[model samples]
Target: MSQSDHDCLFCAIVTGERRGHIVSADDAAVAFLDSRPLFKGHVLVVPVRHVETLTDLPHTRVGSFFGRVQDITSAVERGLQAAGTFVAMNNRVSQSVPHLHVHVVPRQRKDGLRGFFWPRTSYGSDAEADDYAARVRDAL
Candidate 1:
């Protein structure tokens, strides 16, 4: 960890210092639901270690991290029964959070969502929210 992780919210979540509703995890990476989702099944895949941006991640960890992200994207599509997924990561500009996180949002044909024109909404309840997480976890 670096001095930045000490103040990073995602680092706290990864380190168990803060609560993140995790969907799936391995030694190298973790996946969790985005609190403010573009869609109901939107997920955020992140590396276990703190890194400011994609370029900040160690070269050796790239495959492990992105591989987990790919798996999570598949799970998002399969678990939510969506036609596909919108898998993306922000560098520094629009990255709301400091830690690197890939967005794997569920999508269907004509779902009315547009590119980068995000329309956010909340999950109905804790149980409902957790079930979304569980679905992706099971799909993994």
Candidate 2:
């Protein structure tokens, strides 16, 4: 792909061409809040380099990318006081952004955030959504 390409949403975010609620950033990668979150405090971490999927990235970069994910997960847990966290990556079938990225989802005991195998329901209302955001922000 051309260096100027912005078709990839993660590339846009990394280059500041698209707006994102960024949580953390560095020379190599960035972490941002997921707009369509499965739960509160959900974050998406991506490398600055534009790679279509995990296998597309260099093996060395993969280690660093996941290292950043771990850091983000720790921050999310401390920031949200989350009971636990679930981290995952998608390749061809599950990939949404068509860029290598990892999802760090915060889970709570009563929130019914089971593993990835479990289905998720949408927030009941705007108020509920706001409440969830506030709770996670408070922890942050």
Candidate 3:
């Protein structure tokens, strides 16, 4: 553990310094029920290490970390008998906690939550869309 780990809420949960309704855990990651859920059975999957953001996570650890997330996605859907699920991650913006975590939210038709967390918008024109795509591709 590092200095940052001691300050991270999720790290405390992983190390048993704090309480979390843990659903799953292994060498790679730990998963738990969200205290404030979008719906019942919503789960948060996080790496065991104190990674602050997805971009900060090592490439070598990515597959193993997300593998745990994938397994929990299945378990949450099956265990809750949900129609489906909404999985998401906020890297830094809108991320209440700094530690990297994936949200697995159970979903059903007409379950109140709609579209997503924000309103939809369009690029206005094909040229505008192409410009945005080109910028992203260039960055890649």
lDDT of candidates 1 onward, in order: 0.88, 0.86, 0.93
Stretches of candidate 1 exceeding 4 Å from the true structure: 118-140
Ranking by TM-score: 3, 1, 2
Which lDDT tens digits does candidate 3 get at residues 1-140? 79867789999999999999999999999999999998989999999989889999999999999999899999888988888899999989999999999999999889998867898899999999999999999999
Top-scoring candidate (lDDT): 3
Q: Model 2: what TM-score?
A: 0.78
Tens-place lDDT digits, model 1, residues 103-137: 99999999987876568889999999999999999
> For residues 9-48, what per-residue lDDT tens digits would candidate 2 score against the true structure?
8888887888999999996689999999998789999988
Best by TM-score: 3
Model 3 Cα shift for residue 48 (angstroms): 0.6
Candidate 3: Cα lDDT at 47 = 95
Clashing pairs in 1: none
